[model samples]
Target: GEEAARAAGAGDLNVLIGYDLRFWRELSALVGNPYLSDFFHRLRVQSWMCAVPHLRRAGDLRGRLWSGHCDLVEALAHRDGRAAHAIIAEYNADSLGLIERLAGERSG
Candidate 1:
């Protein structure tokens, strides 16, 4: 699951990943949709969920999970539209590993 998600997200890091800084500008450029301010609230919740204590217990699972996100976002935004969104969708779909890890920490 993690591998698949990484593969998906590896393709479209911009459109799907919200914590990425480039999310808004690229979004505006592509779909003419501006970044909604409320998105940050969701971002914090999602990130906090990922950076929880248990996952980070081994001194990992904390910090930035995907620092490469913005780079991919920028790359995808400048490329084709449908293709870019598809890649982003792949990334969104592939987020299962992070979710699993997060769930594991929550349960344990």
Candidate 2:
């Protein structure tokens, strides 16, 4: 995951997205709940559907998104659930903000 994040930081969106899905899928599976795993899969796909266009428009993605993924991986590695949760929360908020900003640019 950290390697993927670094690739993403180098501007490879496909690598980032692919690894993100895999990361979440594995994490959800670790909970041993098939339902949650399925839900996460669907949710991730839907989010990509909505966000990909905007993301593509941004150019220079190197510093624009998912920079926290490496930190999240570190948190999980250390078994610090609280830190992991916070990192995820921050990532989601940042992603939403980026989408919103890009949408506004499109509309305006």
Candidate 3:
């Protein structure tokens, strides 16, 4: 997880995207629900496709963009559900904000 985060920080977007997709897919699979896993896989891929252009346009790839992933891994490893939820919430909000800003910049 930390290695993937570092790769992302170093501007290796493909590595970051692949790591994220695999992480989420495996995590969803842990729920033991095939339908849910499939749904999440499709949703994650679509989201990544929508964000790819904006992600590529960004100059700096460091900082919060790839942060929290290691912490999330730790939280999940320790079975801290609340901490994991908070991390996911923050990550989602931060990512959405970045994408929206990038999209707005491109459009306007």
Candidate 4:
């Protein structure tokens, strides 16, 4: 899907690839740098926490189910590190809600 979409688009694709946690670490180092700050400002992010940590740390057993999706969506949605984190947070919360309804309770 990514290649197909890129082919259809005219602009050169700029792919940012890195482990979500690693990416967050890099962003953490950029806070004092003006260029990085400017980039985040462009992405409309107010805080570093929004994008970094896009992949929520899995909780017990149930949290494992939501981690990948939360990371992927957040990673793709925002250029800034903090937005990813926020999206992941939202995604994980929503996923937990769904699981609660479907599985009732995960005791084991």
Instruction: Estimate the TM-score of every prediction.
Output: 0.41, 0.86, 0.86, 0.27
- Each prediction's RMSD over C-alphas, in Å, is 8.0, 1.6, 1.7, 12.4
lDDT of 1 by residue, 1-108 (tens): 233234334433332244343343444445543455456546645764654553345343223244334445556657766765765665566455666766776688
Task: Give the alpha carbon lDDT tens digit for every residue of 1-108 in model 4.
Answer: 233223213222122122323344444445677676556554533332442233222222322322343344446556656766776687569646745544543343
Give the RMSD in angstroms, all C-alphas superposed, for model 4: 12.4
lDDT string for model 3 (1-108, tens) is 776677666777878888888888887998999999999999999998987777888866666375677888899999999999999998889888888788787899
Worst 10 residues of 4 by lDDT: 8-17
For model 2 the local lDDT of residue 75 reads: 93
Which lDDT tens digits does candidate 2 get at residues 1-108? 775678667878888888878877887898899999999899998988878887888877887776777788789889999999999899889888887788888899
For model 4, the superposed segments whose C-alpha errors exceed 4 Å read 1-78, 105-108
TM-score head-to-head 1 vs 4, winner = 1
Q: Can you give the lDDT of residue 42 in candidate 3?
A: 98
User: Which sections of candidate 2 miss by over 4 Å?
Assistant: none
Candidates' C-alpha lDDT: 0.48, 0.82, 0.82, 0.41
Model 3 stretches with alpha carbons more than 4 Å out: none
- Residue-pair clash count for candidate 3: 0
Q: Which is the better candidate, 3 or 4, if ranked by lDDT?
A: 3
What lDDT is reached at residue 31 by model 4? Answer: 65
